[model samples]
Target chain A: MDFVQLKKNCKKDASAFPGYRLALLGDCATQHLAMALKGAAYEEGIALSVFDADYNQLDAQTLDPSSELYEGKPQGVVLCLCTEKLYEAFTLSSDRAGFADATFRKIKGYWDRINAHLSVSILQFTFVERDDRVFGNYALKEETSFYYQVKKLNLLIAEGTRLVKNVYPVDVDSLERRLGRDKFSDPKLYAIAKMPFSLEALPLVAFETVGIVKALMGRFKKCVVLDLDNTLWGGVIGDDGMEGIQIGELGTGHAFTELQRWLKELKNRGIILCVCSKNNENTAKEPFEKHPEMILRLDDISLFVANWHDKASNIRYIQKTINIGMDSIVFLDDNPFERNLVKQTVEGITVPDLPEDPADYLPYLQSLNLFETTSYSENDRDRTKQYQAEIGRILLEQSFESFDDYLKGLDMVAEAKSFDPFHYPRIAQLTQRSNQFNLRTVRYTEAEIEKIAGDERYLTLYFTLKDKFGDHGLISVVILEKRERELFVHEWLMSCRVLKRGMEEFIVNKMIETAKEYGYASVVGEYIKTPKNAMVETIYAKLGFTDRGDHTFVADCATFQPNKTFIKE
Target chain B: MERNEILEKLNEIFRDVFDDDSITVTEETTSSDIEDWDSLTHITLISEVEDEFDIKFAMKEVVGMKNVGEMVDIIEREA
Candidate 1:
């Protein structure tokens, strides 16, 4: 969207939508940027209430205890320290050699103080690279030059913030490089109004900022639903056969190769890759199985759905089998008719407008930033194998006569243990990403998880499951707070991939066992209703806990019978 | 473009930017005549006019344009 359209969106009434409070702290004037942020958020069904700080008050607002920044109680704080202001500081500094480190120290102090007051996510804008070019080409070798310092400062911001779990660098430096410095900044506008970015660049910056907010709020794409023919490679796989279809590093085939390489990287990073195609099942499997030049093999895909039905129905089936929200899936198809059909049918799925030329596919997709994740762990690399095992279990279930028989035949094993420092990252990620099976959904960062692991008042458990097929790594998390006479289930969530496999029964039995061992008379569980968590609304009642009629369920530890499950703990 | 033609186009831009259909601009019309026009909207108005005319307004013209007639003069000269 352009500046005018985004500005007009600011006037629309967004009172009914979900609201996100954000405090915008910038050294430059931020009225226009605030408007653009709200406008961009409105387009995504988020009513962003921005607390725009006063002009050049970054120090005053962040340092003071009773400042408006604290009073606003924002869920997020955005810090924009522009390159123009940084250049002025560089020019006035007495010691240019230590400029980057000193500036980074001051910025880190702001993050530390704000985090001490409130546990809110800090979205910091990296310094955009700008040079006066006084030393020309020799500036690259000069550590004291403004250009060199700015580059080093950007790197320092990235590396320094890695130690803090709540601080997220917005990478505005990359945005400037992509848009070109001239297009991103206009000196005349900066001189007139103290605004750093041009009107045209404001919307892009606003979108990028809101993207991080969306991910932090537990809204992000988790899977990529792909089309095989023409979309993944050149020509139809059915007509061209496995050998004739283009993929590798020759001619237009190189374009598809690059796209597949990127998709492979995404799969390795925990984004589930699924296939929904309109070709024959065998024909679609042939290319992935037999083609020598194919970058994506049959093992890379989690759920492969190749049928003769319309793509919209096929995609819905894929969504149902994977047990993720339709909004978390991105559908890519080369045909406009298929794209429009799926776009109109699916309510929340993202279907990008694939360009006509095959070569423009990867570049266009990269610019959209379809995948934005807040947390990652080493366990993410094993996600594809877990899903593939799930598919294997599903196929095995079809041959069984009864559901109980299928569960017992799988030979499932589970391990439950208290929270360790090693599993904290994966536990926190499950809290942020799992929405369907979550009860009283409370998102915690890695730091909060670490605190909970050390605190005596809270009891934490992380569960892992494996069957005869493969291992589902660190699938569930339960955090219980000890009360006067009972244990309160503060947070309980599980990965949807492990649903309907007697995992909930296994977890509840473990919870009561722990409470009995601790000498608590009763265990209480609460179910908070959300739009996506209705699947688990009556879960406690179904698990034999007496409903207390006020969203709380009670189980007497003395009389509680251990739930019968197929899994051995 | 004729002077009257420029005025007619400016009237459309003014109505669109201010979200009003009845706004009619002439040589005497300025920021004071419009209820929503301020320093913030003034920059937006300048940007809209530049985009519509496919011309770049000088920094002076952006901040110092006295009336709708002055805006039209720049558009006429640049167009």
Candidate 2:
């Protein structure tokens, strides 16, 4: 496959929908590979910019900072060294330690500088071994020296990547196993095309690199539609009964328990767990509720529609019940028939390839690597409990005659705080994910968030909500960029759990008051429409914002008028 | 065999694996030269080539096949 075609496929994947900005930086050895990426970007609908440094004059700092060369805020950056060329750079400089540490430190410095300058994810590449004779230069003969240097550089980069949470090392060696040698060795193709690696290698890297970005960007499926029977346990609950099922302490039963434990972790991360099994509802309910050793519970599940219906239809009902998109769902079942049924019926649902061995369950589940959440809030620990509390609140709503009476009974408190370094990582994650209630779903990396913090014109607000039930954690994030006489609300998004809590209004009102104090004449905001965010379509309109076509809604600070019954605590 | 036939075969391999018939295989064609040609597809392409050409490529050889011409040369030698 060509890199271009693979890139197209990547764009089609739900995870890379809005796509990301990618920057390619490499030595002369990778010139063709870089150009091929540009071509791939054109075909795949992904935005990728390639930068080629002159081989004769290769200085990282000398490269133009503002040169649209690096203009796009790339989610991932690829840095490569042709083994022989690096050997040349090593020999060219008389001070070995100077070049060694300087080169390694420069890579780290690049990330530090970029973290301050660019709002994107970074991916660094290690050097691949080349046939010694390929290079015309002779002093580089101990090619092993360059190989060791490259390996050392990769380890250093990996260490740096580990330290900075946003950086990733895309080791070509791991990629080579998946893609063979014939495709990777063609120098002519690479030299001319700017893609010298195997036809197989590029897409894997492109997808993997993009996967890393998507993960860093904090965009992942929100729900897992599970099939009972062999999925949740080793055997069927109806036929085998609770005693016959294997879902208890260690050994054969322990594998299933481990899986259930994994599911518990997934649930804790705010992934709504829903059971869509084709069995007696009570039977399925027994394992979750009555089974003493069960890791997940009836309350743990957001929806339970266990009837003998087409699994796809059940999944559809769950999606609607949860008020989420079909794309944000993963269907898991041991039965190939059911998995195939859902895959054929549900257009966007991700059905991972399940293997035959029961022992393969952990690896199979791990392989899916489906959910990639970068931001974990304190609320994440008790997500199931909080959501259940929301369910309880729903039940109490029926008893109350008035909305305020119900609100007053709950004793809800909404607290807004300024962005602190301790919460920056999760705050940045919220910016990347949290789609539905988002004013403008502007995806950003933590590095970029740090940069935004330094700029005085911007304000990043974090909101914490709790009632008598439990702490809902930091659930909402709003970013405002202010200019002379006016403040622009760059981003505003709240966790779906806190949607109806009147927190959005409270935050907007806070922004308005803040703007007034700053002497800004008006507060401007935008309501960008997305496939899943129709819930917030009339938010600005309801808050007394005037529509300024093209989805930009504005509110004049002085003239703004709205019914406010905010009981701030 | 003529270089053109070899190129055509290589091009067919790229087209079939990439699922894009429009790709014309030049001697200089490499993964970076084409889009959608990432590491995963690179493996798929190599496996397809192994089945097509009936040749086993070593780690170094596979890594070395940077372009269509290089892939052709490696295949012809092994074949």
Candidate 3:
């Protein structure tokens, strides 16, 4: 879809709740990135409104600190950082089409300022290798410098992002990968064309970058479900038997083992791994428990169900157990029948096309990028062990049949911490991906979240859950913006794994207490209807908040009753 | 290849770029003669012609490619 069609679709699709308002800022040089962003927004279910400005008509003053451009509310704003504009901004005289360095600085400065207000801002780094082979006949070394300048601009964008929270660098290198090196050598062709790529590249870049923006701002899937047999290994475990199955060194067997190692790595990246296999429970358990070659032990699986059940039904069982939306679950199967069946049966579960070759499995699964993240920290590496601990927690809960009994047996300990510098990245990620239990569902980029927290007008809260099992890491976030005496709950979402565990009670209770401490009259909640968030339609009502129109829920802080059972820290 | 043969090869590049099978070629045929000869396609067509003929034209020569005649003359000189 083009930018216009994608925007229209995103506005109409009920799944992309908390729609985005976008501003496309650039001259001719940046138009393709704008187009690419539009395509990406459509794919991501984000409502985008684009305003393309004429390069020659832009006024430096408007993009300055005191201008209204920064004042306009947009979910995300994209800027083109090409050398053509940079050269013009540096050298062109005002009458003929030149601006002072101050103007360019102001442009960059204003974007930083806007990022301080917006939820997400994507900056397209300057692309080298434009079709300039003949236009300005520079030597080979000069062309190398031109390419070096793009890298330098990318660094500038990266450093500039530190000043604004949700500022993200779109990899121009990856964007240019579509354009082969030969396209740059022909002077007859390259001289007249300023843009490097074909018309096809524009929509694609816009679409993919917008996806990056949404991923930075919106919610991602919470759980990754695996099918055994050919998916996790080279051949069917039931057919090959434990001894014959591929899980060791050399050939196709090593491929399956490598895929398992990758999945284990993914688990470390916080994608919960659940096994839905059709095998004799005893038969499947043999490799997991006894085989030394097994890369994924029983402890590796967050939820394991081995039976003859339909794969989709088994996935639903796990989803219900976790209390997460089907949209947040990614199912992988080597069998096309099982994959097609789940795709037909489950409306929202993402089942990527399975590869036939065992060697292709690792790349195919990795390419799905179920746990794609922009920023990586040391703590993310330990996500698997935490989920294993959660599985242990689930097993511990089975000791009691009743809900209250389960709560009592763990001697539940909940720690509530306000947002700090350390938890910023995790909090930003949770806000982007947590769906079913999200109230309001306002997505935030890292820069936007930082700005929101820095501003006195907004209060952001992050909750780290650790029951008797262990720490669930930073799994939940609540964003509130001040409106006179009221704190408007702009964004509230919790990782679905922590759902039904009374962790929501712990967080909401904290919000109520916080409202009282801050002297706010009422703590308002919102339940914006989204295709994936139907589960949270009654979350506010269950928490004793009065429903208002347009999915807003309200409750007075004075009369709020805290669920006394959740042990607070 | 002589000038006539080079022009014939160049004509093929033009036909492919414009996606027109029945396009007539002369020294005076400009991009305006056929559709799909926008800026991007112009680059593609010229690049293909240069590769086929093993000769590169200057940027001024490509930009000055108003008619088929100018394109043929540039190719003739370069080749």
TM-scores for chain B, listed for all candidates: 0.95, 0.90, 0.82
The docking category that best describes candidate 1 is acceptable
List the lowest-lDDT window of 10 residues for candidate 3 chain A: A95-104
> What level of docking quality does candidate 3 show?
incorrect
For all candidates in order, the CA lDDT equals 0.91, 0.70, 0.67
Top candidate on TM-score is: 1
In the range B1-79, model 1's lDDT, one tens digit per residue, is: 9999989988998888787899999988989999999988787787778778888888887889898889888999998
Candidate 3: TM-score?
0.59
| lDDT (Cα, tens digit) per residue for candidate 2, span A1-569 | 45545444433434443455566666644544554565455443355545544442224432557644346555566665554456667767676545545567877776777677676666776656443343445425543344445556656766777788776766665565445655554543443333446555655555555455555555468888888888788887899898888888633777778888998888987888888988988888998888888898887787778998888888887776666779778888888988898899888788887788767887777754677555567867766665567556765676899888877777778887778888888988888888788878898888887888778889777889888766778898878898888889898888997676677778788888878888898888887788988998888888778888878888888887744644365
Tens digit per residue, CA lDDT, model 2, B57-77: 676766667677888888778
Contacts from the true interface found in each model, as a fraction, amount to 0.23, 0.00, 0.38
Interface RMSD of 3: 8.1
CAPRI-wise, candidate 2 is incorrect
